[model samples]
Target: MSVLYHAVRTPVRWAFRLLTDLRVEGLHHVPSGGPFLLLPNHQSILDPLLIQSICPRKIHSMTKSTQFTQPAFRVVLAGLGAFPVRRYRVDPQTVRVLLRLLDEGQGVCVYPEGERSWDGALQPFRRGTLRVALRAGVPIIPVGISGTYDLMPRWLKRPRPGAPVSLRFGEPMCLGAIRDRSTRDRRLPEFERQLVREISRLASVPISRETRERLDAGSASPSGEGGS
Candidate 1:
């Protein structure tokens, strides 16, 4: 990890834990060190930061290009190893950067949904996301982040802290060799759909029974403790 990563990570972890009842599971699914794609559901802007906070390795993320407009913010993002990608457009440079990072044995994060969900539900995976993973021939780790949608929904002016949140990482999946092109067009959508199903399932699963118990206890408190 870079010095800047460690510097920001400590505070990000502490803030989430203090602001909300945060729980993470399936962390062991991520390899200790490797080149792979980190795919996560996007609910709020917090999704990327949350993912980076818990990951043990330095993660390079493809952030929206507009975020880089500010000189100060751009510097901070660059220091943290983030690159910009123009959304809803074909940006070959972005893809090349991502593939190069993966080839260099570094992890990169991408939101397959292309954009955050407005309704706190899983959005359909955007086309071509899986193609990137397949081309790189790297294991793809699916991460599901729940509760952030309610905590910091798009409509909210700011996050309503104290909400319970969970982040779960699913097992690494390798998209075996691509079959010959005789029927690839028909098979490509199937591959993306299956991956989407796995991500959606992970999103719905709670962090654990223990987290539910904690939430139950808090709600059952005499003072009526509850998420904000």
Candidate 2:
């Protein structure tokens, strides 16, 4: 980590710890070194910052590309090790950047759910996140967050102070085990199913077929109304 990153992250970390009474479980599951991807379920925007606070090592994260266009926010984001990701479309530039970061032994955070669930349920894993993992050649650490959405749900002005939050880190999964099989077009469906199953297990939340159907039909709430 750069001197500037530590300088900025330290204060933010302290603030989040104080504000949320954040509690983390399974920290031991995280590897001490990197060249790994952190895949967390997306329920609220606060997910990224909360993950950063609990993480033992620095994490490079993908933010909406629109965030970097603003001059003031751009400076703040850069200092905190965030990079831009175009939403709803696969931008090759963003993929290249993420792959390069992972190859260099850095940690990267990707939300496989694509967008936050409006009704506080886990959604299907987008195939794009898996693509990044396959190309990056890094192990994936599945992280599960609970209670953040309730603390600052969409349509709230500010997060309710003193809300309890939980973050759980699951065992690391090696991409190499499935890479060869997934490389063949015939095995794509099986690859995606297994990937989602692993993530769901790591999350430790039972997701029923009915719940998945509901979430897929639901729409995400507007951005900025909730904490990121």
Candidate 3:
């Protein structure tokens, strides 16, 4: 973490603490050291910042390439170690940058949804996002953020103060070559389901106990375990 990044984060963190009743759970699940991929469900634009505020370590997440066009924010975001990604398409440079960051032992946050959900429902993981984690060979920590959507949905101009929000981190998933299957293509669907299931469980949303249990059992399989 850079001095500038900490300096800036301090005030922003304080503001969030005051504005929202924020609580973090399962923080110990986050590894204290080494490169790890953070997969969070995207609910609002505030998702990344809210996650960063409570995290013990600094996070370097991929921002849309267009966000860097602003002259001022570019410098600030750069200091925070954010990299640019061209959304809705595969950009090799962005892939290389993410892989390199992971190899260098820096924490990186990527929303598997690729974009914030409009209906406040969990979205599917982008296939590319899963592939990157697998290629990087790092533990993936699934983050479930609740209540931010009501506080500031896409149509809102500003956040509503005093709303409650919670961030829950789940156990690290390590999806090694499943059952000696040498091909990633075969494992992709199961991998995606496992990631989504973890996020849903962590979110604690309303779902039948039987359904939840089934998803849990499906995802917990050691052979197809998903931390990719």
Candidate 4:
């Protein structure tokens, strides 16, 4: 961890916890070392900070490219080891960077739901995210963050605080090396369903109707979460 990460982590975590009654579970599922991916849902803008505080491993997060355009915020984001990614369309460079980090045995976090939910429900994930995990061939941990939306949702300009929050890390999921194009295409939906199920279980939240429909339709929408 960088000196800045160490310097501000404790204070940020302490304040965040105090504000939201933050708690974590299934932390043992987080590997002590080596590369892994932390896949979580997006709720509040604070979700990344909350997850980073609770996660035992040092995590590099994926931030929206627009957020990086701001000089001041960009500096803070870079200091905290976050990288920018274009959310609306496919970005091959983002995939390359994520793979590089995993190949180097560093932990990375990506909110599978490309954006925060307007109604605090789970959104459909980008299919490419699953592909990345399968290609990296490392432990993929699904994280469930509850109560952030209530405290500070995307629409909420300020945090209300006092809402209880929890981070639940699911057991490591391994898709192995999915090299065959035909087989991967045929079974991608099944893998996606498995991840969605795990995330719902850990979070104790109902999957949105959109998620249900999207899964059944077997489509990867352009706005689906992953790089955002």
Please give the CA lDDT of all the candidate structures: 0.76, 0.69, 0.76, 0.82
Clashes of each: 0, 2, 1, 1
Ranking by TM-score: 4, 3, 1, 2
Q: Write down the worst ten-residue block by lDDT for model 4.
A: 219-228
The alpha-carbon lDDT assigned to residue 113 of candidate 4 equals 80
Better of 2 and 3 by TM-score: 3
**Tens-place lDDT digits, model 2, residues 1-228:** 777677766776787788877778888877788678888877677777788766878888888888799899898787778888777565777777887887788998888776776766667665566655655567777888777777776556678867777788877777563344336233334545665566566555556564456345542221111102
Error of 1 at 56 (Å): 0.8
- Looking at model 2, residue 14 earns an lDDT score of 83
Best by lDDT: 4
Model 2 segments more than 4 A misplaced: 177-191, 194-228
Write one digit per residue (lDDT tens) for candidate 4, span 1-228: 888877778887998877878788999999998889988888899888887777777889988899999899899899887988897787788888888988899999988887888888899887777766666778899998889989998998999989998889999987776666556666677778888888888877789999999898876433322343
Candidate 3 lDDT, 1-228, residue by residue in tens: 789878867777787788889888989988899888889888788887887767788899888888799989899888877888887566788878887888798889998777777777776556667766666678889989888887898778899988888899999987652323345545655776777778887875533354345445553222332221
Better of 2 and 4 by lDDT: 4
Off by over 4 Å in 3: 177-182, 205-228
**C-alpha TM-score for every candidate:** 0.85, 0.81, 0.85, 0.93
lDDT of 1 by residue, 1-228 (tens): 778888998899899999999999999988887788888888888888888888888889888889999999999998888899887567777888888898799999988777777777676554456556655678889888898987898777799998889999999988753534424334555566566667778888322343234334432112111010
